[model samples]
Target: MEKCRASSRIVIIGAGVSGIAAATRLLQNNFHNVQILEAENRIGGRINTVYFGDNVIDLGAQWCHGKQQNCVYDMVKDMGILHETGDYYSPIKRVRSNKEVIPHELATKIHDIAVKSMPSGPHPVVGSFGTHLAQAYWRRIESELPELDRTVASESLNTFAKHESSIIGADNLFEVSVREHIEYHECDGDKLLHWGTKGYRRFLRLLMHVSEDSPEELGLLEGRVQLAKKVTKIELACPRKVILRCEDGDYFEADHVICTVSLGVLQEQHEKLFTPPLPAAKVNAIRGLTLGTVNKLYLEYGKQPLPDGWVGFFCLWLEQDLTELRKTEHSWVEGITGVHMITCQPRMLMAWVNGPHGRHMENLSDEKVLEGLQWLFRKFLTFEIPPPQRFVRSKWFSNPNFRGSWSHRPTKADERKTGPWDLESPVLGEDGHLGLLFAGEASSRNYFSTVHGALEAGYREADRLIGHYTSCSAKA
Candidate 1:
């Protein structure tokens, strides 16, 4: 029985966190015949860390998010590599598009009021989170502030909404399901835990059980992954084996196949990727869940350093200014709600954009993007900021491998009664055995759109196969 388990061929699609975690767990359980097929030339699907300026900066997954109940945090808590970040909202200056500085106290008050009015937990009523937030926010704004401050507060709330949209990977809160938003379980503890210069790729090393100081690879995973293997089809009609055909004219047969591709890729390729097509329920689940875009623009300042004690800029644009900008090509700059200094990289500033604007930014030329950034800075900042020495940006939306950033539960998801559970269901072969399995962050019920969620999902699928083999061994 042990020999049979060890000899069973297993193939995992994508070399992302979920795929890596699945392979790691399988190897630990004596499943030696495992291979990870990655479409890209490199590993770490969405956890991309690159060297920028003087130190390392994360282009993909940046923070650990929380410490409690977070597997990534628990694994590295004792390593002395993680640090708690300061309050993300406070100690920052708020500047309007007209170059007027909002009083710190007033900004804090508006932020507090807005946050307090948001739904804290799931409600019996079903609706869009955006609708609930806007209605509740306006009521508090009307009762708390004078007419003079009302206009600025309302504009500031728009900036806040943009920030929320980026966080949830949605174009706007109105598209997100209110029930799912409240149902998301946030791990209790520090909300933003920084990895410093080490970067999020450190978590991948931990999964492989590799030491940071060593230049060695784990024996189980060494040569186990095949890069640039874009799998185009999964033939599951075979009664005894599952066949995978890659775009490079290569093929592999496996007793079991686990797919860890992103929800975006699944949405784009699922129709033609599977043989005999996926189950109708699974297809419905894929259509119901949405993959949103959240992109980052990094500006490197080599000669001119940022102002002292500088944290970030929270931008507030008046209705008239926004209306005027919409006429110009730089209108996409309005999508940028804020820009902040990278905690570890002192010479770098990160700007965030999401939804339609994020996708638009991807299509523009580098010169155009830089010019837009200059225009944005000139309007909001009091100081004379020069163009960056170098600029780097993420193009997740334009990347063929990843159609968007991550997954989010949209309002349609509730109406359709479909979600991660349906997507994660295994497909049975003609022999009445599990042939195809799924694992990814989108498959996580409570931890969707997080690195920890991806890790957990991978472990879940690996454990499923392990349990099945264990049951068979016991029967023997």
Candidate 2:
């Protein structure tokens, strides 16, 4: 048996924030024998950005999340990627019956009341987030509230339900929504938002800073991250070494291995992937939670700074029976309810779409996708909407590696209910020796789905491996 050396090599799967963090921490801690194995030819996982002329668009993670206690923010600052104030939640652009854009101020006021005035304390009746948020709107909106049966579906409740689904990536609207948690937890919606690259990539690079999103960028960053390394199997049976098999007929043996692949990959391809097999509990947790996608439609309107600055999401509202949208697929989509447009400088606007509705919209062909937009465009304001001079889209869900967007609030049954083991991914054998170990965002808790979450988890796993070895050496 090959004795694990203090410099025993470590292999990290995935080049996202988590994997990069783990490798960097190990190297910084004097562990030089480490290499990152990324299936995609890029790093940073979901924190991907695209360069179009002067416009810097983010196809993956666009937000920096909480600023108050956000660790990634500090890292960004450390990396000198300064951030300015943002207007993400505000200017709540909404499309109305007239096909004209509704000022965000109106919804902001209503949302404020609803959020601040939510009911408190435990309840005998346990309802889904949709039910809770709908009720919250009723209490806060008060007179502004729409008709409601209370006994059944209410207008305000249904709208809230749809809004929640659109925000969260839930399979259905009325089922359960991640938006409730965001609204319930986040006191202030205003936080750091998109600013070209805004040091977002720089910050991540400083942390994990391994590979770039695209093949070209990888060359730009130098070949620190190994690309096109499709991980076929992970063997952790021999406690001191984890062997990683690549599809390209290559192999890597590491003292510890971190599996930072998304839950989507785990859930979708777990049966054939694991060598020693993942815990039954962990497997169940992954599948129970749903993975979603967010596709963007960037429209460059011929340098025309029209009135109201491109009307900022100026599009028509769909008239589907909100209830039907809540269903997975009720025959077909009824009609456009609303359109969100953001008119910005350099002539560019993005249409933010997520959840089931976003999925339906993104799956369509480029021509069809544009047609859907034109349907809303024509219904709202008539203009010579040209076949976009530039088009941008994301294949996050379709990609086998990514499967979909980042993690969401796992289902009640899916949520991890216990200690930190779920957070401490292992790649070694059961004999207390090291074969391999894995950790990353999907392996993290509390901070999962965020860059910091991925960072902390990566560090934790590295520390675990290093600490265990340190103790064993001390005894010797």
Candidate 3:
């Protein structure tokens, strides 16, 4: 390891996983002077852990996603959290159709073939996933899964494809779409899926490990992180450094600042915050690209325990044509979607809506949606669902800090324009000499949305900055 270097004061904005990870790296690299300037009072920006009585529900990210290359899983491997087993490719026992339940292992085989058809090298950067992979995969899904209702598999594939396009089905999969765009940029070709039966949202579980210790104690929990403080503006003309101003009237400054806030936040409030202003290209990217949002509608009910071999899904068609079903937008997906009922121990049924459909749900009152869910229960289960003793939803888009889930899938034209985003030079001098640096999931070319992606970006930027410093010092 390199010996301790100059104590250059660095200010890191945003306290989410990426921000924290960057701080952790600076300190670990023996960079003595590092301070994080978060706009909010809480450290975990989007990574929120809420307790509804006894449930440790995650409002932000929970999944380890692509467990094979997950930084989160590596961090928690030694933490000793009970039931934290890795079971991504769990069997698909129930289909939203009117046929016998397909065997879990066999269903996964069919799913694998579908994934194989996906375009290699960065998702979303290509054509609409709904048109390509979803349609193509659905075709294969039906032919492969024999004895399965042809229409049921088709619908499932379609819905799955929409997820690739929609905010919900993507990364941060259970809820937000921030990670989905990230995953598209990072992964080699395929991504893993964790069922989360033991605990779906693993990202929060990992963050719970970080603030567990203080610096002196050498444990991650001791670090104090405040929640709820929102930043209003930021100025980089602090003579010798950068200063951050929040609506709370608190001010902070340091040598170099890492503005790790979400692109969504930039899209919403940057114009009001930055004095000198970001370049047109930067501003346009923030505004031109839409801030996608989606919410997971969780419903709880008393177990009615359906008959044996009932095989789920009252629909004989929707589930069968899964491929085409994903294209079904807004109101259409609301009706024919999801395995809302099953005899799991937790007894919580969830349906995720994305794109315009998600916005519709977000706009409606909880009571109205709850009423609609009641009707759904009666329509599908032939019984009324228990008015959930508890209810929860993630409002990432509505939150001030996170304007929307995260960046959308990169586009084809973006490649030539934003070509080699990796080589675009870190936050540096006006002459590109290297005074400032940028690091975050958005900055990620390979590992965009995942924790690993952000971590890798931090490491890459750190290396770039360190190299420049080393070269200058050596020349002297």
Candidate maximizing TM-score? 1
Q: Using lDDT as the measure, which candidate wins?
A: 1
Q: Over all chains combined, what TM-score does candidate 3 have?
A: 0.73
Candidate 2: C-alpha RMSD to true structure equals 4.8
Better of 1 and 3 by lDDT: 1
| lDDT values for all models | 0.88, 0.59, 0.52
Misplaced by over 4 Å in model 2 are 1-6, 78-80, 97-105, 117-126, 143-167, 172-190, 195-199, 208-224, 304-306, 309-311, 314-345, 382-386, 412-428, 434-436
* lDDT comparing candidate 1 with the true structure: 0.88
lDDT head-to-head 2 vs 3, winner: 2
Q: What order do you get sorting by TM-score, best first? A: 1, 2, 3
lDDT of predicted model 2: 0.59
Better of 2 and 3 by TM-score: 2
- For model 1, residues 1-476, the per-residue Cα lDDT tens digits are 22367889999999999999999999999898999999999889999988887877788898887988898888888989988986876777788988887888888988888887777674735888888888888998888865637678778888888888888999999999887788788998787898887888777887888888778754358889999999999989666578999999999999899999999999999999998699998999899999999999999987435588668888999889899999999989988988887787777888998899899999999999999999989888888888898999999988888899989899999999988898889988887778899999999998899999999999999999999889878888
In model 3, the runs with Cα more than 4 Å from the true position are 1-7, 78-116, 121-126, 134-154, 166-229, 238-240, 284-291, 301-337, 340-345, 382-384, 412-416, 419-425, 429-436, 462-476
Q: How far is each candidate from the true structure, as Cα RMSD in Å?
A: 1.6, 4.8, 6.2
Predicted candidate 2 versus true structure: per-residue lDDT over 1-476, tens digit per residue:
44333467778888887787777777767676778888987677887866753456677776666666566665654543454446543453444434545446655555465455333444413445655665566664556544423322233234444444545555444444333243223323335544444335655645544344543443322445798898988877554567778999898887777788887888787778877777775665665555666556666656643345444442222345334334633212222333444323356656656665565665667777666665555544635555566667776777888887765553353244422244354534777665555565655555555666678788887787678667767777
In TM-score terms, candidate 1 sits at 0.97
- Tell me the lDDT of model 2 at 288: 58
TM-score list, all predictions = 0.97, 0.82, 0.73
Error of 3 at 76 (Å): 3.4
Q: What is the lDDT of residue 213 in candidate 2?
A: 53
